[model samples]
Target: MGALAGLAPIFGAIGTGISVLGTIQAGREAKAQADYQAKVQEMQADEAQAASQRDAAATYRQGRLIASQQRAAVAGAGGDLTDPSVIDIMADTDFETDLAARTDIYRGEQQARGLNDAAVNSRISGKNAQKAAFISAAGNLFSGVSNMYSRFGAQAKTTATASGSTRPLYG
Candidate 1:
């Protein structure tokens, strides 16, 4: 009886290992996909940051150019200042256009990243679901085995009673 108690723990360990291995195997693919998605997200964020910094620099330079042009016109006009200087803000306009274009590109890139993350997460969830189903099936099989074990234990008791040997506590 004491030895059987010890053996029970060993069998439990074996069954637990089998169940966990199945789950790990199923999750491996999902893990790989998630890793890939994470890298892609990182790249997208880096690209967005670089573009934003460049846009800021370009906009600052364009502002300086427009300011310098207005100063030059003031000096060139000989203080008459009669006609309104048609300060074309195409430098600012071009900056606005470039910034808008960048924002649009970044949005599309991030959207793709979001989609990839969703797909990978869905795959991971599917793996977990499959693991759950496997566990459920294993539980059903163990239930059947437990029923057979109980029936056999009863037969063992009857035989021990007839044979005049003391029944073991558990085996």
Candidate 2:
């Protein structure tokens, strides 16, 4: 029993160390998960920008094709390409096509901006997780020390009382 009692502190210390390590490991995993999420968000942002560019290019191509077809149609119908009304129609088509393409680009940019914000948020979350883990580990260490003192301190008090000693057994 005395031998076991002497080993109690060693066992407690080992337990405390394991607990602190586990807490720190959990925190690291959380940070890692957040980092992975941030990476995914960054990739998504890149894809959003690329998709926007592709959409804008397609819009421009379609607009050019429509304009060309309209011009061909006018020529086939014996219409004068230099007439004021014909020129106005072509201009309107060009304007509308440009507006639509620009709108697509704007929409895409907004989406990419949102995704980038999410990525930043994820990275912040990761940092917070890491900080929290360190705090938890410190708390575990303190708790373990307190537990050890309480257990040993109580035993000292008990022994002092049994011996009818007026002096406190421990400071």
Candidate 3:
């Protein structure tokens, strides 16, 4: 019984250590999960940007095709390509085509930027969680040690009193 009682503090310390380790591990896992989510978001952002570029290119190609058709039709009807009205129409078509293509690119860039911002936010959140976990673990460790010391210290004082010790427990 005496030996078992003496081992109690050791067992308590071990338990505290285990608990602290578990807390730290949980924090690390949370950080890792957040990092993974951030990576996914980043990939999605890249995809959005890529899709926007493809859309813009397609818009440009469509605009060129339309312009070619307009030129062919005017030549067939014997209309002068250099006529002010004809030039205005061609210019309008070019302007509209360019605007549409640029709009697609702008929209895509906005989407990608939003996604990247989200990824950055996720990373920050993950880091905060990890830091909080470590802080919590340290608190637990300190509390555990304090509790163990108080318990042992009380027992030691009791034993000293019973042994008729006159010396102070702490100089």
Best by lDDT: 3
**Mind giving the per-residue lDDT tens digits that candidate 3 earns over 55-128?**
99999999999999999999999999999999999999999999999999998899999999999999999999
Per-residue lDDT tens digits for candidate 2, residues 32-52, read 999999899889988888888
Question: In angstroms, how far off is 15's CA in candidate 1?
Answer: 14
* Model 1 per-residue lDDT at 164: 55
**Candidate 3: stretches off by over 4 Å:** 1-4, 154-156, 159-171
Write model 1 residue lDDT over 33-66, tens digit each, in one string. Answer: 6566656666666666566566656666766666
TM-scores for every candidate against the unseen true structure: 0.41, 0.89, 0.86
Candidate 2 vs 3: which has more lDDT: 3
lDDT of 3: 0.93
Shift of residue 71 alpha carbon in model 2, Å: 0.2
Model 1 alpha-carbon miss at residue 109, Å: 14
Candidate 3 minimal-lDDT segment of 10 residues = 155-164
